[model samples]
Target: MKMNICMVGALLLLGVAASGCANNRDLIAKSVIPARNDVFTEGGNGAQAGRAVVDFTLLVKSNLYYLMGTYGKHTAPPYRAHLNIDGQTTILEADPILEDNNSVGLKAPESGTGWKYQFSKRLTLAPGKHRLSIALPIDDVIVEREIEIRPGINTVAVTPVYKRKMLRPYKGENFSAGVKTVEIAVN
Candidate 1:
């Protein structure tokens, strides 16, 4: 009789524990990742030039030299930089243009910043502050920045830089074409 009572008590405890775990299986949501993917998508030359202007702004702040905004979504890493020395604005091209894509070039022997340029004899930048005007490649947005030059060794931190990804074209297609939701049980 005592053994039977003990069995009943153990069963009751086991059932209570099982039920507690089952109730918790509803998911208490330890962390909710509310992440949003904000993007920009437009087509045409006007749109591209607009992108170049946007990229020029974010590039200089952190050091990557060329930051991409929403407008630079169409092409694979698109941007051309132009620096205004005094009153002259010179267009700089990527070195080995096709090889590096200058898309990721961050070397400027002159200003020591970044420009789509080849370091041919340590470039030239007069003492003072200069303006940068970047061109959009493949219809990219433009972002502008200002750089200061002083005669001597200068260093800038350019990290956390991101490469631009092509904006996927939007078409009226079924988003849930073949997606199915199913659940299975494991023992």
Candidate 2:
């Protein structure tokens, strides 16, 4: 009799755990549902009509750099990013211009002496709360945050920074550590 009772108890616990997992899965699915309407419109056409304008910029170092002869000619790999806002995903590619340490305002030794790629987008969105996500698949960098878009023009800047341990006296400009922190600023 005791053996049968223990088996029943274990079965009951397993059923409850399974049901809890199902509930969590349902919640996750609901949260990721795509937006019903296309919210991100390019350019500033609707800004005066009450839509908010957002100028977004993303800057990151190229994954690989080559030294040509002794001049150290740097080349930028084709960098692409996936940006998701309000459950809608958009793909963005870096601009043709490749900036160096001089234009980026970073010291050579500290900045890794690499070419930087930049991506910019001007978007018009409804003024309200938004969920923003950025993923750089090649660089293995992902950032997600909640942003409030107010009326008029807004500037959003996203840039990758060296890991804490990789900076300063320890060792600066080390790409081996990869990008651990991405700084986001909205103005």
For residues 1-187, what per-residue lDDT tens digits would candidate 1 score against the true structure?
A: 9999999999999999777544322221211111221222211222232132111111221122234631111124433333332334433334322122234332321122222223111233333454433322222223335655444322222111222222422322111111011111111
Q: Tell me how candidate 1 scores on lDDT.
A: 0.29
Number of clashes recorded per candidate? 19, 0
Shift in Å, residue 171, candidate 2? 1.8
Would you estimate the TM-scores of all the predictions?
0.27, 0.64
lDDT of each: 0.29, 0.65
TM-score of predicted structure 2: 0.64
**Model number with the top lDDT:** 2
Runs in model 2 lying further than 4 Å from the true structure: 1-37, 65-77, 96-112, 164-169, 173-177
Top candidate, metric TM-score: 2
Q: Give candidate 1 regions above 4 Å deviation.
A: 1-80, 95-122, 153-187
Model 2, span 1-187: residue lDDT tens: 9999999999999999777544333433343345544878777755666689999898666535355622222234356766778877666676534334544434333344445567888888898999887766555566779999999899999877754333453545543344555678888
